[model samples]
Target: MRNPLNLKAPAAALAASLALLAACQSTETKQETTATTVPAETSKTDSAAGPKFLSQPLVKDIYTADPSAHVFDGKIYIYPSHDIETGMPENDKGDHFAMNDYHILSMDSVGGPVTDHGVALAVKDIPWAGRQLWAPDAAFKNGTYYLYFPVKDKQDVFRIGVATSKTPAGPFKAEATPIAGSFSIDPAVFTDTDGKSYMYFGGLWGGQLQRWQKGTYDANAPEKEPSGDVPALSARVGQLSADMKHFDGPVQDVKILDEAGKPLLASDTKRRFFEGSWMHKYNGKYYFSYSTGDTHLLVYAVGDKPTGPFTYKGVIMEPVQGWTTHHSIIEVKGKWYIFYHDTQLSGKTWLRNIKVTELKRKADGSIETIVP
Candidate 1:
């Protein structure tokens, strides 16, 4: 297990700074913003966030979540789900997260001004998409940038799709149909050192991973998890073809194990696989980080190979002021940073804002958990 790093700034000083910022903003008609202070350590017992912020939003003009951040040609590009209010009520099936389009956010460096390059891809342009263009990831191969996303088809079933562009910020052109044998939500592409790329995808509950357990869609799959010590469901991974659009082989299970090399139990909500699978290589170790959905923690596991059998290590970040937690990790200029989202701007789960902060590693190689 990883050890927790306590980096606490004075609460009184932070409160005073927030008050000053709010008092200054009260004179203007703009939306209220928080002080640009680093995230401080908070009580783990209290999941709900207080007035202090871990980091400010990267973009405020539009709600964005499930950030998939990458560095291409020395700049940071974020592919995030464009969140919008549709007045739809919330449910276990996630009807309220009615995001229908995607926008690309770019910046030359961290803490720098970000540019939103308008709409990269929208539901209306994709002939096969039904609705809710969810979380996406991008990759560059053979001089072409490919956008991998999960969207429901006309049959109302979620399928992964691919779009291509010559440039990173794209008015991308999507293929006519979803990728063959793709299912569930949050498609993240990881290109390893040897140039082989793999797509890591899947999520439980509303993400519909539960329905696909039988290798076919079972709409009547039990919504509740298994009882006793039954092994929990895990995320899916597949090797990408040379074209980067289709899976080269069959989708395989990404087994997340415990210290004793046993599958995490279904009742282990605190450490089980939930959603938002991300892979990054650090010091020759493969780090598989993901959100713990209902538990609201961003945790990770370590493995030697691109495809795991990764062992659960520890939490990366605590629950933010939101119900869902999704993120990505990237190393920039010899420094590592994590990009994530929280409901700080709207206080509603569906309307979230993306943020970034530096990620530090301990001397023993375990990650230092951040409490946001």
Candidate 2:
């Protein structure tokens, strides 16, 4: 069967699909605050490893795909849409945007070349996968891996689905039905220090943050839908119970931040524009980072808590020679780095490559950008 996100066929497509199905059906949480020190420079000299920072493409010749990376068992695992071919044919329309398969890549160090372990997840295996698989985000808790992905069913309706696996390089198993049931995509999972698990999703239509109860699917039960004062870009945070299933609190808007870590006036035009939200706590402060405009640039904000009166920091990075960039931030061995996709190779969106670079903090506690 043809994959959802349209791409030219490759010799190994069928084998890759089967492998993913076998791996996905298997899997199964907390947050803690730890002190992290900021390093002085972008590049660190190490006698054993040579250099502390490097950049390489994890997956090659795919379309503009978003990536989610996490460290598991001393390895870094990346889950991104499997957009195979360099570009889509002109006549292809509708649901044939690009076919997606989830693959597992790993390395011992942050700057190493990611070795592909073939396909880890695929659409055909899941009864409801339909054809398209959009963005897939994975999180490891309690010895199991949970992968939340967006899929289009046979009816061409888009929604999010969850798959489980025992290992990061998975054989994932699908749930009976989608968790949220909303026409949503790009699902990201986050767990807080209070043992609460939350899932964040949505794009130009705005974003939603829902709490997962100990073992249930009612993310919207606690909070009433906004009666009137909703921002154009939608982002809500709901509390999750310990088991990572169900909701505990009302879903509410994500706190906005100003440049000095203070609240900013909400702008209707700016709400729907921000994309790619990732949360991290550093030095006792919570940092919420996101993408703005055409995906070529990245900006962030900070607060004392996850539900924030966040203040914007500034743009961390922009397109050096590429048009748009999608990124994730990771800290390895006392240093910070940003992993993102860039369009420099093909320049037309497809054939974009994953790039990594050292992240530096300014004297004012802001981040510095790397020019291509």
Candidate 3:
């Protein structure tokens, strides 16, 4: 039977290419100078103090979620899944299944309000964008920006696509139609220290890893299937060409960890051992963070490499007030922080708000999440 998805290049080559492209773009642009500030430690005397962590609302009125932040030209540019609620109701397919527009929000500081830069990229602009445009991940390389995103056709089937722009906040143009093949969502692009690039996706179809080869869009090429069951969630890493359009090797599965830095097993009944894979390297070790269970508890693991033999680090943050969380981790100014979405302000699931908080690594190499 033929797989319904189209994929280009083996997993490794594709990752390498993305890294190169991001690096090249970084070199061409001036680095943003506005330093992201970490909040001072809360005083024990302040009994009424709210959660120690707080995130300034970036975009308002419009329901914006799944934010990815990148610094460009002295500003923090956020690319988020955009929806239209104020204008002519552009109903692509009924109200609930409407498509999205990728918009860029800029701020001078991490805690600053995100200013609207308008629509950075949109579905109608891409050739194969049938309707749904979800999860936009951006990387800069060689004076150009690569915005990778997941799109669905009129049928609501998902595929990945790449777009290029000269600036982070840009009029990005699609490079190709949904990258050949694949039915995946939550596309993440990463570039490693050795200049290798990788792309990871696959939550619903279990976890899959593919390498990108030059001049091809075959995600299965040089395929390396994951050793374990499709993690309730999983992430893959690989090397990419400097150009950011090709791959150099195979994609590998990353491991989940417990608080003591031990591996955690996914419950066979899908009770939430793993989901939502996010990665970052600090202090010579790579940290892989993910969500668990329907409650969306946060957990992490540490590894020597992007791909693991990782030691589980345990729960970083648990669902608050019965609210679930989806998050990403980033390091700024040598401090680690967690960026996650929650139902604090808007109880509606679709209206969940994004939050950021300082994360402290214990002497044991585990993280303590501060609630905001």
Q: Which numbered prediction scores highest in TM-score against the true structure?
A: 1
Off by over 4 Å in 3: 1-56, 83-99, 205-233, 255-265, 268-275, 320-324
**lDDT by residue for model 1 (1-372), tens:** 011122233465345434643543342223222222222223222234446677877876577899999999988999999787778877777878877778888888888878777678888789899988889999999999999999988888888999999989887899999999999999999999999999999988778888998999888997645546899888899999999988898999999999999999988999998889999999899999998888889999999999998999999998877688899999999999999998666666777789889999999778999988
Candidate 1: Cα lDDT at 262: 93
lDDT of 2: 0.56
Ranking by TM-score: 1, 2, 3
Q: What is the C-alpha lDDT of each candidate?
A: 0.83, 0.56, 0.55
lDDT of 3 by residue, 318-367 (tens): 66422234566666666666666643333333333455566888897778
lDDT of 1 at 187: 92
- 1 against 2, candidate with superior TM-score: 1
CA shift of 346, model 3, Å: 3.2
RMSD of 2: 10.8
Better of 1 and 2 by lDDT: 1
Poorest lDDT segment (10 consecutive residues) of candidate 1: 1-10
Model 1 lDDT on a 0 to 1 scale: 0.83
Clashes of each: 0, 31, 66
- Between candidates 2 and 3, which one is better according to TM-score? 2
State which candidate, 2 or 3, has the greater lDDT. 2
Where's the lowest-lDDT run of ten residues in candidate 2? 27-36
Q: Indicate the residue-level lDDT of 368 in model 3.
A: 80
